[model samples]
Target: MAETPIFPAIGAPAPDFDMPASKGRQVSLAAMRGKPFILYFYPKASTPGCTTEACDFQEALGALGSTGLPVIGVSRDSMKAIDTFATRQNLDFPLASDATGAVTEAYGVWVEKTLYGRKYMGIERATFLIDADGRVAQVWRNVKVPGHVAEVMRAASAL
Candidate 1:
């Protein structure tokens, strides 16, 4: 029900958004300036694919974390869901809830998805690599689950 992000080019400005984070704090994209950031949009917290993505990031935290970048996960789930997901998976990164789907819209991850020939609105698993200057450096849309963190880590290290 929202517009997809126009998806700024590799060197274009990363869209700025503020949403409720897993820690109950407001996270604004601008506040992340001066450091590379991983903005991954998922459909819901605790789902199979979503959980895999979060855990992969968690498992690779040593490499990605060493880069001094923030790995932020966004979803349309609520704080309750995010809390449980983080606790259950022992995820180390912050999980933000975009209940209204605004942030997902800004990032262009909210779109129609197909499952068993049924089409409905959902969050596409996607990741955005925002550089230190708040520009989009790389983007992985409609992401597959396996080895995603390795790919993202490789991209982050190159930045």
Candidate 2:
């Protein structure tokens, strides 16, 4: 019964958000100004596909970080869940908890999904590449986990 949110368009300012992140910190799009960053949304923390995507991003952290870009994973999971997932997966980047689903809604990743013929509302796997000035430079919707990080790296490196 949830209304789908309109996704931000490329070259437009990304939705600003400040959420509780793992490691006892807060991350905000505003704070990451003057540098490009990646904001990826996942359905949940510690799930199979989400885990693979997070780990892949973690593994590519060195290459991605070399571009002076920070990568953040967002989900509707609680801080405790995010913290535990990060610790268990050895994730070196930020994993933000969007418990209220507001951030996910704003990003337009909070969507309707169906599996096995049952429809439900959930966060869609999506990623936004925001440029240094806060504009969204790229977007990937319904993301497939494999080789995703590498693709993002290629686009980011070109930025």
Candidate 3:
């Protein structure tokens, strides 16, 4: 049996990351230093759930940005796929490609999952809200799409 992954606790420093993102740019923890941000992990690009989540974030971007909390989506998909998805969704926020799974694992979103009695390893739908000091302020795991962005926005607004 695989050991359960441990997530970074609230108030802990967020794991660092540097990944290729849409619009031919790099999204990294270093670049977001001294700034609050949202890092959301999704299972795949262009999938139903992921699409809804991405689109919701896009729609809420202006409000979230107003709170000084930029959002970044991460997935194990390749850059090509991420770029295509971002373009299709008309997303202005960065959707980063973690082709190597390093960032996902570091953040503890990579885990064992079972569907219809079939077990597999996959990225869990999770989100982390990191404060300006680089500490984790909030976390959501096994996230349900409906009303999720609004919940995140509320937490960010409080920060």
Q: What C-alpha RMSD separates each model from the true structure?
A: 1.8, 1.0, 0.6
Cα lDDT listed for each candidate: 0.86, 0.92, 0.95
TM-score comparison, 2 vs 3, better candidate = 3
Error of 3 at 18 (Å): 0.6
**Model 1 agreement with the true structure over 1-159: per-residue lDDT tens digits:** 444557667888998888887766678888898999998988888779888889989888887778987899998998999988999998878898888877777777878888899889888899999998999999999899898889998899999
Tens digit of per-residue lDDT, candidate 2, span 1-159: 676679999999999899999999899988999999999999989889999999999888898878998999999898998999999999989999998888988989989899999999988999999999999999999999989989999999999
User: Which has the greatest lDDT?
Assistant: 3
* C-alpha positional error of residue 100 in candidate 2 after TM-score superposition, expressed in Å: 1.1
Cα lDDT for residue 141, candidate 3: 100
Clashing pairs in 2: none
* Poorest stretch of ten by lDDT in candidate 2: 1-10
